[model samples]
Target: MVSGLLWPIIKKTGPLLMLLGLAAGGYWLNRHYREILTPDIALGERLYQQGVDGGGHALQGVTQNDIAFDDAQFNCAQCHRRSGFGSSEGGNYVLPVTGTILFKPRTFERADLFNKLFKESQGQVFRARMRSAYQRPAYSDESLARAIREGVDPSGRQLSPLMPRYRLNDTDMAALIAYLHQLSIRNDPGVDEQTVYLATVVGPNVDSADKTAMLATMREFVEWLNLETQGNLDHPNFSPGYRSDFAKAFRLWRHEVWELPADPRQWPTELASRYRRQPVFAFIGGMVNGDWTPIHDFCEASRIPCLFPFTDLPPTGHTNRYSMYFNQGLILEAKAMGRFLRAQKDPETRTVVNIHSGEPRSSQPAKTLTQSLHGDKRYLVVDLTFESIEQLRDQWQKLARQQSAPIQAVIWPGTFDKTIAAELPLLARYAERLLLPSPALEANQTRFPADIAGKLYFSYPYELPTAYHPHAFRVRAWMNTRDLAIENQRLQFNTYYALNLLQFGLEHVVDHFSRDYLLEYIENEAENQLNPGTFPRLSLGPGQRFASKGAYIVQLVNNDQRQIHPVGDWIIP
Candidate 1:
C-alpha cells in the first residue's frame, strides 16, 4: 500500500525535475553558442566607436537634446571616449558608462568623484560621479536602458540639459553593455614584470655627432630614471601621488637602437623584423636627414609611439596617432620664407630664386616652399652645386644675370660657409633681399662677415637666444656637469626635453600603458605644460603633428654680432 501510493507522486515529480534540468541545459547551450556568434563586447565597442553594426552596416542613433541628432552624430564613443569615460563639453559633464562604474555601489566624496570616473584618481578609491549623482540603488540592465532612452538617472532625476537621450534597440544596447564590461581591462605588451622596453630609431644619413649625442643622452636618461625608480622597480612602492595599484607598474627602462638602411624602402621591412624580434613600448628620439615618411608609415602601421624626430620633412596631411614632430623642421622655414617673399614691397618683381646645393636634406625646404605656392610661379628653384668659393661666386653671378627682372628674393636653405661671407657683400649688390635660416648661419657664426650683417633676413624658428637661456639654464647646467660636449645645442636640448616630457607623461599614465593614451597625454598635456627647451613655445593638439607651429622673420643686427630683431610678426604658415 505504501509503495503504490508513493509511485504516483514520484512519477509526477520525476517528469517535472527532468523538464527543469533540460531547460537549464538548453539555456547554457544557447548562451555558449550566442557568445561564439556575437562576441558581444567587441561588437558593442565597434557599434559604439565606429557607428557600425554587426553586418558591416553603418549603425545610426537619434538624439532629442539641444539639437535633434537624427544622424550618425550620435556615436556613443564620440562624447563618452572609447574607454567609456565620459567628457566635459560646453559646461556639461557626460556620465561614464563603464560597467565598473555603472554596476558598483557608491560611497565617495564629491571632491574625489570626478577623478574616479576619468581614471585619473591616484591612490584614492572613489565611486564614479554618475553613481553618486543620485540616491538610487545600483543600476539594473532595465534601469540603465531607461536612463539612456529617457535622459533620466536610476533615481528618477533628470540628466543635464545637454545630455542626449539615445535610442538603441535591445541587441545593440546589450552589445554596448557587454563592451563596457570589458573596457580597459586588457594588458598591453611591451611592458613586463621588471622592464619597460623602448626603441630609438636612426636613419642612415644622420650626422655621426648628432647620432652619438642623441644616444648618449637617451642612455644616460634611462640610467638615471632606473636609478631614481630602483626601489619602486625592485620592491614596488607607489609614490604619494600615484595609485596603489600602480606600485608595481614602475619598471627598468631597456632601450634598443634601430638603424634604418640607406634605402628608404628597406626601413619598413627592417623595423617590422626588429619589432618582431623585440617590440617596444615607445620610440624616444630619432634622427634622420632624409625622408622620415617610411619610418612614419612604419610607426603608424605597427602602432608604435614615436616622439619628436629630428627631421624637417615629416609626412603631412595624413592623420597620425604615433608620431609627433618638433616642428615642420626645415619645412616651416620654407613656409616662413615663402610668406616673407609674398609680402615683399615690390609687387612688380615676382621672380624669387631658391638657391640650394643638390643635397637631399637641403633641397627639402625648397620643395616644401614650392609646393606651398600651389601653381603660383612667383618663386623659382635653382640648384647650384658649389664646390669652392669661385664656383659659388660664378653661380651667384650667373643667377644675377639670368633673372629677367629684379629678383624679389633669394633663399639659401643650406648652411653658410666662410666663403659665403665674402660672396654675400658682393651678392648683396645684386640681391638685397636674401633669406637664410638662422640655424644654418648660427653654426658658422665666426665665419659670418661684418659687412653683410644687416643685409640678410633670417627665418628664426626659435625664441631669441636670451629668452631661451632662462628656460634652458638648468638643462645646460646639468649637461655641463655631465661633461657632455655641447656640439649641437638644439640637438642636446631637444633630446633632454623629449626625455623629460616622456618621463612626466609616463608619471601621469601610471599603469595605463596604451600607446594611444601615451601619445594623447603628450599631445594634450605635456606639450603645453613643459618648460620651453630650444623652442620658444612648444604646443601640440588633436590632429596636430608638429609641436612648434610658427616661425619669426628677423633681421640680423650689429656688425658680426649675430644679434637679431623681429622683422615681422610670428607667422604660422
Candidate 2:
C-alpha cells in the first residue's frame, strides 16, 4: 500500500531519489497542505478568535496597565482580523502579524502598510485611515511572541496601549505562531496564468432582441480588452506601467453563456450542469423579467459573484453576499410612491388605487406598493383583466365617475399601450391623480394626450433623458462604429455600463480574480466614477445591493411637447 501511494507521488513530482534528495520536496508538501501540518494550527486559530485554550478554557490577556480582559473583552481577530492583516478603528492602527509580513526582511511605514490593508478590505466603509508616524521592523519568532506577551516590539519599543498582552504558555504561543505562519497563504480558484473565465446567465423568457444586445455588449468589450492587451496575452510578464502591476501576464477573458429556463425550479439544475462543465470566475450583465431570487440563491450558495444584471426586483435586506443589482426596479418605484403618499397633507382622506393587468410582472409592483402602504388607510388594489381597450376605458370611466372621495393617486404599474393612452382623455376627471412608472410612460409617450402630460407624475429611477443625452449620444456613436443597431436602448445602455464597471473594477483588482475581491474592488472604486451611463449616480457600500439608491419624481414641464422635469429633490426610499 505504501509503495502504491509513493509510486504515484514519485511519478508526479519526480523520481524517488530526487524526492528524497531535494530540499524542494519539503517545500512542495508544505505548499500543498500547509494548513494540515498540525491540529495546533486549527486550535490556535480558534483560540485567537474566541480566546479558547487547548483545554477548552477562555484565554485571558492583560493590558500594559495591568487591567485584565476576558475572551469577550479581548479577541485577537478584533484588532488583527482573520488573515492576521490587522485593522484600523478611529485613529488606532493595528499591526500585521501574518507570517509574510512578520518574517520578511524589510520594514514598512505605518501609512504604507495601512494603505495595503485598506485595499485588501476592498474599500469597505467605516474602517478608519492610518495617521500615525510609527514604523515596524521585521520580526523573528521570539520577538513576535514577546510583542504578544510583553507588549514590546521587535525594536524594543513598547506597543500601543490598545494592544493587550496575552498570558500564553510556550505551547500555546508556538501554536499561535504556527497558525499565523499559514494565514492568507492559499490561492483561491477561478484564476490561472493563462486565462480568467467569466459567465453571464440569460433567462429563457428574456426577449430575443434584449438578449442579443446584452450578449453583444459583453462580447465586444471582452474582444476589445483582449486586443488592447494582446502584447502580454501569453507572455510571462505583463508590460510595465499597466493599470495593475499585480498581473504579471495578460490573462485572456473567456466568456460562457448560461441560458436558464423560464421555470425557476429548473434553474438550479441548469446552473449546476453549466458550472460542472467549467466553473466561471463571475457572472455579469444577465437579463431577466421576473423574480431573480433563484439566481441570487445560486450565487450565494456557490459563493460566486453575480453583478449588475438587468432586472428590477432583486433580493432585499442586507443578508445577500454575492449578488448586486442596478436598482430595485418596480420595488424602488413602489417605495418612492409610498414616500410621496406619506408626504401628502390629507392622504388618509383620499383613496389610493393600484391598477394592474393581473400579470405577475405587472401586479408585483402593485402588491409591493400595497404592502408598503399597508398601515395607511384608504388604499385599494384593482386588478384589470380586460381583453379589449374599450372595456378598460369603460371600467376606468366608471371608476372615475363612481369616486365619492378624491383619488389622491391612480397608479398604473404596468406598461401602457396606445389604446390605453388614447382613452386617457375620457378619464380626465382624475387626470391630476395619475401616477405611472417611468417605463409605462416611456412606452406610451407618443400616444399620451397633451392634456395629460402636465397632470402625470412619473417615478424616474435614472437621470432625466435630457441629462442622459450626452451618454446616449456617446453610446450611439460607439454602437454605430460597431455596426450594431441602437435596438433596445435601455438594455444596451445598462449592458454597456455593466461592462465598463466590470473593466474598471478588473483593472483595480489587477490579477486577483477571487470573486469576493472583485466585488470589493467595485464597492470601493466604482461609486463616484461610474459614468458614461444613464443613471444620475451609482454607488455601493458594505451591505448595499442597489447601485442607484434614489429616484426622481418628475412631471412634464410643458416647455416642449415631451419635456419632463423633477418636481422636487431626489428621494431615497
Please give the lDDT score for candidate 1: 0.70
RMSD of each: 8.7, 9.9
Estimate, for each residue in 402-515, the C-alpha lDDT of model 1 and write its tens digit: 877766445553544333555677677777567777555665566456566657787888877666345577888877887777777878789988888888666655565656
Scanning candidate 2 in windows of ten residues, the lowest lDDT window is 122-131
Per-candidate TM vs. native? Answer: 0.77, 0.72
Error of 1 at 456 (Å): 1.5
Give the runs in model 1 whose Cα sits over 4 Å from its true position: 1-65, 70-78, 82-148, 152-162, 168-183, 233-246, 356-363, 371-399, 402-404, 412-429, 443-446, 468-471, 480-485, 558-561
Worst 10 residues of 1 by lDDT: 120-129
User: What is the overall TM-score of model 2 with all chains considered together?
Assistant: 0.72
lDDT of model 1, residue 539: 84
Cα lDDT tens digits for candidate 2, 162-224: 789888888788888878777655434556777778899988766687788788877787887
Clashing pairs in 1: none
- How far off is model 1, as Cα RMSD? 8.7
lDDT of each: 0.70, 0.70
Give one clash count per candidate, in the order shown.
0, 2
